[model samples]
Target: MNIVRIPFSILLLLLTTSCQPKNKSDKPETPQIVKETVAPKVEISLEELQNYETAYFASGCFWCVEAIFESVKGVKEVFSGYSGGTEKDPTYEQVAYGRTHHAEAVEVYYDPGVISFTELVQVFFGSHDPTTLNRQGPDRGAQYRSIAFYKNEKQKKIIISYIAQLESKNIYGRPIVTEVSEFEIFYKAEEYHQDYEKRNPNNSYIRNVSIPRLNRFKKNFKSYLKEDSH
Candidate 1:
């Protein structure tokens, strides 16, 4: 239940803009968004989804995370949302402007038959830096921090084991700071936020930040990517 308070104005500015350039040397490469024909999302009935399971992750921005998970083979849908907080039905402005404690999160609905939750956990850590506390790239705030929310003790064990293995291998220079929390309610973001990266491919923030992060994930998880993504 601990929520870090960031200056409201600074939080608003960070949420609205592309990742701020840290320094001349640390700037992310702005890659051109390749115009590709993306396949439409396959509609799944409630009965079908009942056979599947959902996982929640908060890493950096939901826009970036949503795109990453959607590209995965078994992921039925990825919804941009807010979670890891006590707020009831938090709005984007409330989370972005520091009015709510919610972190930018994504609810990943996937078929366990195609991709296991363990593999999804790998993607979560591989796609984003878990070592940076309360920050991801250019975005800095408690709401941008890394969190893996588990719905049950089994899922919690998986997350704990993976983190331990990563730590044992010393994969990160610093300790992984991702919070492993029990699952709670996830308030979906505004309509405009859904499929944002795909719909607004030419947007400044999407072009500069979201696309690059996605491409990096695609490169590493080639086997996990959908055919159209490949």
Candidate 2:
């Protein structure tokens, strides 16, 4: 994806608010009170989540990806996180600035009976430009790279098969650069990052990038989206 220059005023707004910004120094310190207030309420408990299956994906900014998945049917909860790296408990700064190998990722808890892993894989590829290496929209770096994580052989084959089908059909008109990797530990991002799009709709990055990306997904995948999401 090509980088578009934000207007000076919006750029200033992002510098003071966005979690992922063009410049590292642009990130501001979020207040603890703000974090507590903005954190999304978890509708499901850990015990109930154990009854559902979990899928992982890394496609650009988790803020956009998380919102997209949350709108999909059968997805009970979506979490913004860091994955695809060996670093332990990586901080947002470390991952955002390429100090760690981790990429911005999400943990998707879904009901397998309601939405199959195959369909979720479709949503993953459909939501973002997988052909763009180490970049998504205006964000650039390994931290923003696309990755589809599989927890077992069945899930792995499903992801690979879908990619093959896309390639056979020449879906993107370019080689799919998305990484298909085995599942690893996922470090949940700071509380402030959770449900960021919902809480910070006016944020420059959310308005300019995240919401637009999610709207595109909703437009294309209406059947996959929950009724309320429409």
Candidate 3:
């Protein structure tokens, strides 16, 4: 499957945008960081992508979510972006600071012939704590809330059915607080935000939180992973 790679220069810019001054505790404060790097762009034809379907989800950090969906067999592209809110062209700073209601979300492109939307919903719930309200680990805010954005009635039904099944099985032992919202505009996050975990493998937050989250999902969903991911 085809995927986009962020130039190293863009990675530096994105990380700088995401970094904050180190606090006494582990979480970094929000502030700008500056660095430089570069890379070549690989293009995937539109005709190739027309055979795919799209799904939107927000479970925790986009970095973690992006990485998880990327490993799935049918998933062709996963983009870190902002959605589930009414902000126009929102920036990471605005969303993270609660200036806008949008959550950190990913736009997942996948082939339905290989994987169904039902299975994708299963992955979403399995990967993150859906019981938590407006929070995920160290990141806490409305923008970090759990949400499943559906493109149509059929997709919405799939998400609802999975949540109900999980609840009946008492999977989370708490009420699932995941929001089911109609798909609307998906404002692609800053260029630096795309493919974050892949590019910033050594970044502190990526090392501590992102990678562990991804590993846990990979272990649990081995059957759904791409060969290289395994």
Candidate 4:
């Protein structure tokens, strides 16, 4: 059998005790060893998703963003991916290291009837700090930059209007720097990244940063979450 070589940087990261990046570096490490516990299974077929509407957002680590959106009532599924850049089929390493312009993003499939696009925008802004530039919590890089993508003019108007309202209210006490871009292609992240928080419950990053961020969103938006999520 051919042995696959793991990059030294990646190996070192995995061996570290926390997913938090060292002060000298902004790379958030992940655990190399996967636990035996599996994420809860909830598979939605592609055919069934045809009736659902899609939204895309990038607010930080996809792991945290994915989990937050998944908890919402109408959200059908959330997939970690890269967006807001021109690179085609970019890898995690390329995006994570800022080698590609793409930022870590998520593709959300939700029922418009159950949840409106306006509400989804609210969740997007409510969950993460949009005022920060190219950084979220422990991860500090362009890949973690905030972005809200719109597929059409209507969606674009909604995002712009929300930002205006937030600015008017001075919600963050700073200017929101989130990017409002047109929806383009979305390259799904590697399989290991899918449901990462659920699968790696004990992971340092998951336990500390990811879970806390998710919990904060849940608390602030209690009515938006699904019953099972609580």
Candidate 5:
């Protein structure tokens, strides 16, 4: 069982043998090579998160929005947080004031091998209103504005095209005002709000708004649902 004596080159080969396609083109592409400049890390964990990608949205309360996307199958994880903010590591109360420019957002982690950025973009457009200027449902304020934080140029391009498509279809019957910008940082929500819906399903907000949003996403994207997923 002592595998330490085995050549490292063999281990390297085994690690790289299972790479998958990443872009729209069918051409064989190495994700590491293409994404290397896009916040790619020097080392990947044993969990195969190397294949995972992230996208952020700020349609409304992080609680409802986080619960919605977590039901998605290819989606690996959803973290409620603040994004597009001016403050550094702004707290729940600070962002609630809307003075920091931070919006209640969800940072979604997903396996790009199972889902494409375009598909994730589609999921985003479907889950929330891109037409809303600074509000979603009952949550009305600049802090509730819609945003799509892109980590790389590839993601930015996909978001742009998707917005264009929505505009052509008159999806929201107005210009898609979703903010698409380079992802700067994500400040995770308070511990109590991390998995608020799952842990506090009986809570008022979770029971009402969050639960409905979660159920809607599951029903609409049933095929993307996973076992013990969220």
Candidate 6:
């Protein structure tokens, strides 16, 4: 993430504060927070990104997972998609019915140079309640199920170690039921769903749940969050 400077925003805020003193509402009328500008990610060739790695997890709404992964420093992209199902290229509507066998998951594309797969797993554990089986918060059913889609033997070991560490530390009163499986199918979601939280911030679900989730994560992992993701 790269910071963006806009003098107009400062000008607008000054004008609003000085020009409209009549309405003395408790909440001040303020301009929206300006976000940082990031250059479009040049699509990485499969061979180049291989130096990094891929990981996946399903812990609730894809919007939340996508937002969480994007906060991690090493992560290149977090895609909202469906996986661990037999279906092929399932549509959002089809998956919503809970018949696709897919768990709404986020695929993390990250650079190993900036963060390790082990740390990514830690972020996964921190971002969502792993004890909730087949659910995260209020959302229920298989689509919102928790699962760790491991790409290889290394990821399996990393996931196992993290779970054991959490269990030994008594992190939660209940047992963790997150599924650990070898990755197979991954169906990219619809185009608009790529960055649901960032793209549709005004939508009811995105605004109420997704943004709050992202904000909480930002507070927790201030160091890991991408500089511009804030």
Task: Output the number of the TM-score-best candidate.
Answer: 2
Candidate 5 segments exceeding 4 Å error: 1-51, 227-230
Per-residue lDDT of candidate 3, residues 1-230 (tens digit):
11111111122223422322234455545645322223322436779777789899998789889999999999998888899989799987778777788999998889988998888888888788887798776667788899998989988888888777777877766798999999998988877767777776777777777787788788778888999999
Residue range 1-230, candidate 2, lDDT tens digits = 11111111223223333445445255644223233245555557789889999999999889899999999999999999999999899988788878899999999999999999988998898888888899777778899999999999999998888888888877777899999999979999987788888988877777787887788788888888999999
lDDT of each: 0.79, 0.82, 0.77, 0.81, 0.67, 0.70
Model 1, 38-142: lDDT tens digits are 544444687877777899999988889999999999998888999988989887656765557889999999999899998899888888888888888778888
Question: Model 3 Cα displacement at 210 (Å)?
Answer: 0.5
Off by over 4 Å in 3: 1-30, 33-43
**Candidate 4 Cα misplacement greater than 4 A, ranges:** 1-42
RMSD per candidate (Å) reads 9.3, 6.1, 8.0, 10.2, 19.2, 12.5
Runs in model 2 with CA error above 4 Å?
1-19, 22-40
RMSD of 3: 8.0
- Winner on lDDT between 3 and 4 is 4
Order the candidates by lDDT, highest first.
2, 4, 1, 3, 6, 5
Against the correct fold, how does model 3 do in TM-score?
0.84
Which pairs of residues collide in model 2?
A: none
For candidate 4, what's the RMSD? 10.2
- Candidate scoring better on lDDT of 3 and 5: 3
Deviation in Å, model 4, residue 3 alpha carbon: 53
Scanning candidate 2 in windows of ten residues, the lowest lDDT window is: 1-10
The backbone clash count of each candidate, in order, is 0, 0, 3, 0, 0, 1
For model 4, residues 66-103, the per-residue Cα lDDT tens digits are 99999999999999999999989998767776778999
Poorest stretch of ten by lDDT in candidate 1: 1-10
